[model samples]
Target: MTDVTSAPRELRKGANVAIRDLGGELGGLTVFLDSRGHDGETIDADVSVLLLDASGKVRSSADFVFYNQPIALNGAVHLRDKLVPEPDSDEAAAGWSSDVVTLELDDVPQEIERIVVAASLDASTARTFGDAAGVRLRLQRSSDAADLLVFDIDDATTESALVFGEFYRRDEDWKIRAVGRGYQAGLAALVTEHGVDVSEEADEPEGPEAPAVDETPDEAPAPPGDAEQAPAPPMPAEVDDDTGTSSPATPAKRSVSVRRPTRAPRLPVDWNASIPADDGNDWQAARLFPVAGIGSGEEQERRATSALLAVMSMVREFGAALTGRCGAPRGTITTYIEVPFGQDEEAYRPDGVIQVRRGTREWTALVEVKTSTGRLNVEQIEKYVEIARARGYDAVITISNELAGGDADHPVAVDRRKLRKVSLHHLSWDQIRAEAVLAARHRGVSDATQAKVLEEFIRYMSHARSGMGGLGDMGPSWVKLRDAVKSKTARASDKATGEISARFDELIQHLGHHMTGLLGVEVQSLAPREAPDHASRRQQLADSGLMFGRLKVPGAVDVLVVGADLRADKASAAITIGAPRGDTRPLTRVNWLLRQLPDEAKDSIRIEAHMAGPRAVSTAALLGKARQDPSCLVPEEQREIKAFTISLEVPLGNKRAAGTGTLIGSVKGATTTFYADVVQHLRPWVAKVGSPSRAE
Candidate 1:
């Protein structure tokens, strides 16, 4: 099936290849865009293709850059029949998702002379292609594995989009050229360059609007911006025969079409329905069952504090959409998570505080978080309400595991001119989770960091046993999961292995929980290093005999935990810091942090600088390197799951500690030391990272 003269070709910027040599056997050309951002992180990118005629006039185009749409707004009849832009494919590899355009050469019209393929970052992400790593373009035949052209972009740091290459007709022969041109203004600019009408779109409202239906001429102007200028087709003037007089025509009456605003869909389940009347403060009760010298009770309290702060942080970052999903007065909402109150820093401190500002005037919202299974007391509510009122707050919110007997309208606000009356309201953690899911799905969240935080927080709470709602019971609680698997009778063959793996998974979950409770920060489990090779990845994690985990705390260099070879009779604790993926300024931030730490503090911890090149490490290389140094931290192991191309590892506790029992205590002690180290070095770093960006 091969053509004698046809051959695959690789290309760089400004290079060209003859399409005639691509072969007559080629039925169609497939343009594949592989977006590798950091460490398999989600980077929403758009791939568009433009069809041009001989004179370079654009005849048709295809793209999926609009909200909720995965394909071009309009279809080109000359292109492939299947117009799905974000077509699902089984071949998508780890650390990379692909979008493809198929060109049916046989179906291409004779007038079509060229096709240009391009990639762009969505405006919502506020990122450019340069912000993304390892973006690649390839042209090849669908039937044949051979590639006609491959373009690996080395740098596009300031550009949002770039033309990877183009196919064109040169006299009787078809040829391909490596364009590699960038568009800093994103896809809009690129489309404009290809003759798209972007000016009309620019004039339209920046916010989302409902689709227009058949409407009267008078109402048409209120709809689309383009329709505002278009004059309705004129009607002929009416004449009265009896008087032989000409009269101006009256426009025909049109039907009035009115659509109500879309309402947010209710959560699938009433989150409050399953809440037990009494929880006996099980979160705290469970903490009483501590392993070794770790004060589980104190740890749980700290975790509760952290969880509260995390919630406030989400509310703070997402603002009205997150905290006021039920509704808030129209204005910018700002929140401070766990900030001290009163004139003194050591005075009364609340879990969270919010300020909704409308012009010069502002209303305050004070929040108290309770993660344990407990009911809000009338006295506590009254006290907090009194405190809020005294502090001039308009509202007081208490977050707990159970829903109080009241309507969904909790934390309702009544605005007054000078001072507003503070209202008391109780919110269940499940409610927060539900709102986050809703916001993520329908609110079109733009900040990648906020989105990631929301997602991770949800995952963290899903496993948390205290909350009430779908998140409370949809899956087995960690305790129930551990018990169910641990109680199963041992068997031979396949079933035995499954049981063992299930038990191991529980151990991993316990480790995550232990860390969350102890560290008072979000901690997540990671798949075993050998997970990819197994059909049942969960089982692989158990079989790997090494527990791996990640930490998520803003501004601090990412930290990781790897339990020393679990299969070994004895193990020690290890924490990796200065993880590079997701952290663009890893070196600068980490070095700055290290410098601030006292000499004695720095000398106590083992620090290794595993710096590489300026460019991000490829996923394959990272994985291989991980295998080479099991003790070394990699990007995939980081909280954001990015290529921590460079990092530092600090092993806690001495190798003298042995036995599984000692492992727990050793880890507990090491974790304590690690926290101290982080507080000394990383806390200040987080403060710097979280501060507002300064004017350059």
Candidate 2:
């Protein structure tokens, strides 16, 4: 509950958050952001605030406390920059799949000491893709300008090895850049890299050290106006020791007071054990999928990780560990775990299967994993039960994260990426997460590892997901979720989620191939938009005349414009341009048009953004408006009735400019505008006929 009296004035200033623009689509953007506290300090262990289109009310609501995380903007992060419809393997690529504004260099320049490159993908652009193509890498370089057939280093795959290439040479300063592309979306660096490697990190005259990481060269230091040059070398250092040995001597051996032996992390089951050799081509195959997402070596790894997490979430819901308390921590405690329905037997273990001195009831659960494209068939459920029964587990459970799906009828499809609707009995992702955590902990997982796993679980719960979202969701979060009903309700879901058991009569009925489906390996619909609600929302969209969408996650605008940093006249594809605002000089039309849009929309595209205003549409908006507006074109005989004008003149005025100095008073609208080559274009469509209007 919020304290109304303590709310800040800014919260009351206005209720509107001008949204990003969309061209020709009814965007249902749902974003999650954390509101800062009144004291300007962030409230952490944060929560997500949603910008939702709940039945078209356009509300900004907070669902629940969400784990604090770094900001995520799809285009801005995941697809930092995209190439013009290119692939990840197109050229040399480095850095994270996220992070916009990466510093990139065409070539490592000589005389340079450091380098930084920034790359980004517009938020608006990112939302357009449900998912698509992968990223690739090419380590490009050249001994001579024409000698640039730089070697290709694909995303890492055990088979596609380009083990070693001179990432850096002792003499030559290498130049590097990454080119990326998407499905129907433009290409750009998802984000920029300050430096590719240790050496490329530009050194501060009085700052940090530089190491050699990237092939790109450092920035060239300009020649001193009248000073002689001095030579320098990479820094070297030495350490001192207290032992009788020299200062650089190694540490003396010490007795092991606490021997916490390290253990290897649990690894994925080898596909070869269960399935035929795939050439380990899942990543490569993804590149050809209808909607293959980023294929950057790291991106593939990330997606794999995401899918793995989804699977893990379900596993926990199925009860991987058997934990039994003597009611007290004293009775012998024992836990058994495994995958209930996974390809691997280890994943079906259970919790609470201990031999207690006082109690005899067994706490046995069979944790399982299922990777499928669509809905479940009951027969599959029985198979899982059989496996559980064979293992003498108390309950049989199934789970999976990537549930690729399709239409409601044929919801079960085998999706390689598992992008679909999912179901495992009736357990929800959170329930699965909690149970999995308990199971893992009972099974002896370390506290630190448990925390990391919990973190991933929270992220899986945070998307405005579709298709398999419900399966992962267990059920909707909004339903009967009162604190009182939660535990009881969860109990009900837990039974459903944990219903698999070899002894249940339903198991036999579920086993026959003719039994249809119960769970595991059946796909649900991953197709994002199919509900009839779209019809209602579409009507609302018509009334608004503005495309609306939710971010589903935090997002930013990434409009591509002919103009960057806002120029008087620029081109962009995102905005729809109308006739110029007035008969006034073409340049003056901006002020007139700026008044036409709602203040919110105005801020969205940043009209007159140069001046300090609450919010300004970006330069991309202005450029897009300019390029798309019909008014910018010449009239064609009877073919087009619209009229417009083009002229060249020196306006008299003063207008403060952006990125540069101020311009004062005009023979123009504001004498405060700046210098322009003497030509212009003008067109007017809006008829503000009434009284004397400032723009008119």
Candidate 3:
């Protein structure tokens, strides 16, 4: 609708003009939506573009009215034609702006004769243009960067949708028309008029009987107001129109839970090298930086930098592992390492980028890696945050070797006020390593060959934790520790044995810490209970069931205090998966306790059929008690059942010399293997069952 009469050229409400007059070389047009609250506050509204054929019938359209998934069609001629509705902001309502619809004129199909731009109040909020001080559409021409048209609405009334303007072809030329038409109904009604298949809230079942996931199409009986509208056909099922009947309902779709794939199948660690063996040997291969003593100044710097980058690479892999651990379906999250951004050589590069998607929902996270000694500055973090926000990343996580200042378990805060919608977190390398070990262990148990690379990576991390400094001096502590274990004689002084055994103490303590951190429990090492003499302490330890440690892990019904024993010299470690004895020892419900364990634990860990010793209670006796009185299962009467007493250990090396170095090496290797075994064994129990419950 254009007028060639003596009409004002300046665009205003209901103004009609020729687009050829606006710009001759216009290749593209960007339509922007602007609205201000009564108090001059910016308001967020949906802006859309619709293309129509010569007959005024809809050809192709992009709108934010349906589930916020605006259609975007890419064209070879002009690249892209799409709608950028909102900038994924947390304060989307308060500071809302940037809802745009871009149209490449060259990309528009020849059959399309007109382009219509419109706006509507965001469906989420119960507000209309009448509640705003101003609502307008601004058209910008791409060729000359000119503001071609501005159509402002004045009489919005109680209307929620409005057609601001249109660009139409007239007599082999393009013309603009400011068609200020408003609809009292909301966007759904407005979109329906232009042929958009949007499902209405009323179509959804209102009662609790509704299925958790509705795979079938909504086909409820139409209300009086919508009697003219036909019901949607059930998807993936044919509709029989012969007798006006629908086919048998499609089989109810089962909701599937997903687990994402790990990124690194091959690690940088060399696994052929043996663990420390004898008192005399070249321990260079075991050292992270063997050339620390031989390299020149520049060579040393280069090597150090290279080593740091290698560590960062591992950190990147660790982030990829973390993404997989979030339980998304395989291929749902893809990781890109060392992805560069910004203008040139001085560009910002994140160590890794994790792209996650499940159907239409998609998001991204940037990972920044740092060593324990490296500190993240405000300026650098600010820059990364800015870049992450600009690139539309949901989160920016920094994986570092540095522990959190306040709490080791909690993430450290990077000053993130400048990041409007981007979340920032600091995860310690220790935590990442732990998670990787556990995840790799689970994968390893299923298929050891496939998980070899990840297992090697875990081993490398464990070995590197032995104080390998920043490529300075090849630390003697680790070598000395290894050597000390190899040189110990059979009959050493009591003082010397206790002092050397402290290494074992540290190793076991570390295990306790790892277990405590993972299980959210208090794990304690149980030394020979206050024995009077060395002879008495050895006897006490022998009679203590050789149980060296206990874990008091909390559960729904009661606290599960489990004990485990693993001597560095022994080939097996025993874990008693049962509750500690108390006043209600005889009333334990063995069957219910067994049910609590996942199938993996039962299959992997050897389960004892019946309890032994006078203190031990049989599963048959517990079942009889349970049968005699169901009340026996109550909290007060029920004792913790030793569900099973099983040995969980793998051969590290043959019982070598009792020297400190050999002993330490033996414990370290065994502990590393056992960690994997335990994590893999307990995974099913700890993993989230399906998904969190939602209000129906």
Candidate 4:
């Protein structure tokens, strides 16, 4: 204890730091750096923790002292490095991430297990995060098909990755080679600059000696060349996922109904027919160009232009909107698009071209968007009037400025009115979900309260006005709703004190096992009761003959947990375990009326178990007489008064956090307002009582 090992230090450089590895074997080093003090506001320059060896020099140093302070990342917002793994069991309807979805191309999907797609629009730009528009689809399997793992697309942008339905741009006219005969013979020796060879079936072996996925210690090559990274077999394969939608031969209805994946399988043939389909009038302007309600396609305007390219990619202002019913695409002309039958390409990305410019004149506004509702035969509007008459353009439709002009008074003004793209809308779906909740709270991404004003719904289209800004109208997106409101305002500003000490120790062992089976003994101690000491209860009731009488019953038990010192503790008395079942309709016949008796009794005596367990009385109170009742609980036992839960353990250094969030609620009639984002684990107070009140 007298030798602290010869110490001394000195060193300096451009240095820059911030650390706190406490608990790392006795928590030493606590330095802090990045100068600029005295009100200039930036401090921390302690540095010392050296100790390098293998030829790097320095072997003994110690000065660092973490707990270091000084913070400010400007307006602060870096929600990255979330270390994935937060999908908590299908998450409330596809939350937490299924690559933020939206695909409904034409309805008919449900057999999922592996079906993530986005060969276009930015390799599925995280499907525009947040309310993943009717979510469901999820897929994750690959040794290295260019490992995005499942979306990381360079900090993920381009409007959050085109809502991830599909994207893969590189076809300089098509020449990546290798078209058919599928694959397997070692993926035909592997290759792809565009030769995009895809055999997909290997790595199958799932049982016996299931060990050879790859160990090598001898052979290795695959790195960024992920032609679908290989791991196991390559033969015995079986993939069945399903989802569907397609009808324009004569039956149009649908307004809002989702859930698809009824049949997407069959790949090996041109993999996915070279991704095309947009002709049913360019999927009615790509999924209804959202601003209110109605459709066209391009995935209903890919969630407000990936939510306005995550805020200000330039400028946007759609009013009244209302889409679907069909046709309304205007101005810039030049059509000729056609993706029939197999449409739902992740829910209809129509792309028939709709450039709407005039935000200040490059003037070019164009058109072609389409729709019919659902089943539209007659060759789906005759292949959209022969792809807008072989790419000529000039079919002005686009209705809803609130349906253009009915009652003959120009609805919400779109200039004179009378437009025609026709398939169904004149303005409905509750006025486009009421202007998409006032445009998702005027774009700050909702939170105006009154319970989020129906999340400001917006989508009812009719376009064909282009000056270059109709790349399928990418308008409002909110970076996963501002990262789900800054992860719910940093989980409501932290501190639940380990969820209130594990919900007060699981509600005191769930109401202390029904109060130790109604006092038949065996409770040892529950502690924490305080707030009562009238001279230590009159000096333990002046040496108990066992009668300090303080009877106040209307559902007794209020802080009288005499568990251990019952006069020298006869193993903790209060052992009258039996017969006590009352209250069938008391409390002034349910309105819970308690007007008298509680003026602070001196020796305590406020009786009323219907004035002694009702004995056979028959009703008569508040307005005169006194007793009348006989139902002391026994109608098939009676129970309903227990709820409170919380359980925390979160250390989150990654290892895929299996615990940590603890908090509980659902308790009634006393006090409750939890919801700091609904984390859970507390348990105490679990009443399912009903009748058994006197049990041991």
TM-score of each: 0.30, 0.21, 0.31, 0.18
lDDT (tens digit, per residue) of candidate 4 on 1-696: 011232212111111111111111111111111112232222111111111122121111111100110111110111111112222332322323221111111111111111112211111111222212321112111110111111222222222111121211121110011111111111111111111222222222211111111111222222232342213322312333453333222122221111011111111223114337656663333322334452445444344333322221112212212221122211121222222323323222232333322212121112223222211133333343334433443232222211111122212232222223312222322233333432343223312342232332222222222111111110122122223332343122223222222222222232222222222122222332222432233233233311111111111222222211122312111111112223323332212111211122111111122223324322222212221222321121233212111111111111111112111111110011110101111111111233323111
Error of 2 at 79 (Å): 25
1-696: candidate 2 lDDT, tens digit per residue: 011222221211001111111110111111111111122222121111111111211111111001111112211111111121112321213221311111112222222322112111222222222121222222111110111112222232211111111111122332222211111211111101111011222222211121211222222232222122212322222443655353222222221111011111111223114335778555643221122344444343334334433434333322222121101111233333332344344443322122222134333334333322233444555545555455554443334332222112222322322211121232323234334333333222335654455445434433323111222221222122222122333232222222211011111111111011111111111122443433433333223211112111011111111111111222111212333322344334444444333322222232321212254322223423643552432222212111222111222111222112211111111100110110001112323333122234
Q: Against the correct fold, how does model 4 do in TM-score? A: 0.18
Off by over 4 Å in 1: 1-8, 35-44, 54-98, 132-135, 198-487, 490-696
lDDT, model 4, position 219: 23
Whole-structure CA lDDT of model 3 = 0.44
* RMSD vs true structure, all candidates: 24.9, 27.9, 19.1, 32.5
Full candidate order by TM-score, most accurate first: 3, 1, 2, 4
lDDT (Cα, 0-100) at 516 in candidate 1: 42
Top-scoring candidate (lDDT): 1
Clashes of each: 3, 163, 11, 156
- Please list the residue runs of candidate 4 whose C-alpha ends up more than 4 Å from where it truly belongs after superposition: 1-429, 440-442, 445-635, 639-696
- CA lDDT of every candidate: 0.45, 0.24, 0.44, 0.21
